[model samples]
Target: MYTVNQLGKMYNLSRSTLLYYDKIGLLKPSARSEANYRLYSKNDLKRMEKIATYREAGLSLESIADILNSDDTNSTTILEQRLHSLNSEISELRKQQQLVVELLGKDSLVRTAKIMNKEQWVNILRSSGMDEDDMHRWHREFERDLPEVHQDFLESLGCSPEEVSSIRKWSQ
Candidate 1:
């Protein structure tokens, strides 16, 4: 059996955190010492390990408790919901970032906060089944149909001014 302090140290958790787990009925000590201190058996260690894993996956304490207590829990549903929620948050954050860059009126700031580069753009196109010839044709069409937007798009990919100029010249 391990004392509360020993278990906390083993799991890199604070004493209060373990106590909170106990309070929430998520993990109870399997035994008590002679002096009434908490004593965790190996089974408790395994339960704590599962709790740690679920926490790492961004589960709330209540959700963790439900999952631990229910023998028929649908963990995949919970995980998928979390994934969708995270995607929405990321999209909102990207919009906020764009607004900040625009508000500052600093194109250089956009470069500093660059989310993608020319290499990444090229890789994405390649992954989407675009060959070199297909990419050139697409760029030519973009330059012909929406020159200004095309320029901004290239700049957004973190291209230098000189590189953007060369690409536009070739796209013609």
Candidate 2:
């Protein structure tokens, strides 16, 4: 048997984290000591090991609990869903990296990448006879109609997260 602190130390998790897991019904102590302190058994340790592995795979505590309380088929489906999300995030990061490389004037591999900087985008808008008010109206319409697409367009233009946030806020 292991005390809560000992188990936490062995798993590299905080005592509060373990307690929270218990509170959330994700993990419960297998036994209690004479002092009424939480005591985990070998089976508990095995469960904790599975929790750690699932967490390392980026599964949420809720998802980990669901996976643990279910069969192998359910766990596989959850893992596959997480994999899809991770792949999409990786693709977005790659686009952002390419934009950053283009911004830095690194004329090696990313020079031919079709990325439009802020200045070029603004210039194109101005050339198209879109004054400041016209652009604002356009943004408003875009935000009202397709907020997610607007966000993606802003990100593709290499806007900083802060800039994108500000634009979204005002567009609302």
Q: Tell me the whole-model lDDT of each prediction, alpha carbons only.
A: 0.84, 0.88
For each candidate in turn, the TM-score is 0.65, 0.62
Candidate 1 worst ten-residue window by lDDT: 90-99
TM-score between candidate 2 and the true structure:
0.62
Residue-wise C-alpha lDDT for candidate 1, range 30-139, written one tens digit per residue: 99988999999999999999999989978899888877877554666677777777766755665566667667775555667757657878999999999999999999
**Residue pairs in steric clash, candidate 1?**
none
Please state every model's RMSD to the true fold in angstroms: 9.4, 11.4
Report the lDDT tens digits of candidate 2 across residue range 1-172: 9999999999999999999999998889999999999999999999999999989999999899999999999989999999989867965985777657866775567656667667889999999999999999999999999997788788877788899999999998
The number of the candidate with the highest lDDT is 2
